[model samples]
Target: MSTLLLRLAAPMQSWGISSKFNRRTTNMEPTRSGVIGMLAAAMGMSREDSLDVFNPLRFGVRIDQPGTMNRDFQVVYQNPDDILPTWLTYRYYLEDAVFLAGLEGPSGFLAELEAALMHPVYPLALGRRSCPPAEPLVLGIRDVDLLTALRQEEWQASSWYQRKAKWQNITSLEIVRDASPDESGYAVRDVPESFSQKRRLYRFRNVIREQVFLDQLVSSENTENEQGTPKEHDPMELLEDDDVSIKSQNQ
Candidate 1:
């Protein structure tokens, strides 16, 4: 079987894997589902289209470059009329986010996939909720496999991804490795340090972390389908943010 390598990176991208809250959210890294969705969209697949083509394929993600993920949170006031005595807080947090993904399949299918991704019959999203892909590159691989070749490449190789033994039975995997921002690959660099520092001036890192934690708690507590009733929490929570409570302890 052959494989296709697609390079996805953008200045401001968002991949809301399981975001549930008033504030905007972003995935820590690009998601297999999101990438498939992007391809489906380019193929003019409707939201209801079946994803069987991509559902069973072997997949993996590599952290080529980490981009800053900044999301704004809105704090609602208790009283609409009250201004001076209003009790509300709103802010945003910025964190580094970057990832690379590899997909393997039949050679013909791989070629079609690469062309579809490059020309993108339609549109493409780097890996963000709000940002669209500006420049995406596709590398054709016939003799070498994606993960195998990537591991050998010196540009952004990582020991974690180099071990073939660890890849046994792993249809898919994601590696968050250290990468220099200067490396040539897919990367995002829109939210400058000045903006992040300016926002930090208004809200302490501890406070912002707390707010993120509170927002997660509130989100978990307020799960519903527009009627304000709780629904069954899915296992995909693994993809959700880590415990915000720990942020308090650090402070």
Candidate 2:
């Protein structure tokens, strides 16, 4: 199976948790159900459409920039009047966040999704309709699996953000991915079953969390053979074998 890559960078993104009445809260990371919904929208699938196509896919994400949280107060009333009672709602968002998301599936299915995203039937958004992504969200397909692709993908943090990170000496990024049956991981109720408006259903999915040290990006451009041509190699083979490396206590 191959992987489809996405650069989910936007001024504002909000992957809301389960319905929380008037207080619509958001998860720290992009949720599996939220990403599935975005893809369904790109293919012009209605809210009542089934999400069987996504069942075979493995999802993963890396946080390039963990943006700060924000909140907004909104008035839901269509028309304002003294006769009608005032109604209000609160929504949360992650400002200036950048995320790299990967979806692993059959080569053919991933290709189909890539094409659909490039020429989306409906408008594509990072999370909500109001929060549209920057142009060209699709980052093409990768030949490797989901986890490895995310581990080797280039850093997508904004230039200013990178500069800010320098002051703090930040050198690692967090990765969250679907865990296999044998792997022990925490559970989050984020798998979408039915997207029907009347009944938005979800199931728990186990996920593994780890941090990868990003001292520098590893790419073919920087790696060359004796002939001066580009050389391709599996980055994970060159990196550590452990799930993740711990930061030094001295640092």
User: Which is the leading candidate under lDDT?
Assistant: 2
Q: lDDT per residue, candidate 1, 1-251, as tens digits?
A: 66666555555566653344454455566655567667776776655545557644555556544456564655565656666544434223224333445676777777767767766666676544455653324545545665454443222212233233236433233452222234333323221112122231111111000001111111222222233422222445565686557776698
lDDT of 2 by residue, 141-189 (tens): 9999988888887776776787798899998999999998899999999
TM-score of each: 0.51, 0.83
What local distance difference test score does each model get?
Answer: 0.47, 0.83
How many collisions between residues are there in candidate 2?
0
Give the residue spans of candidate 1 off by over 4 A.
Answer: 73-98, 154-251
In model 1, what is the error at residue 59, expressed in angstroms? 1.0
Best TM-score among the predictions, by candidate number:
2
RMSD of 2: 13.1
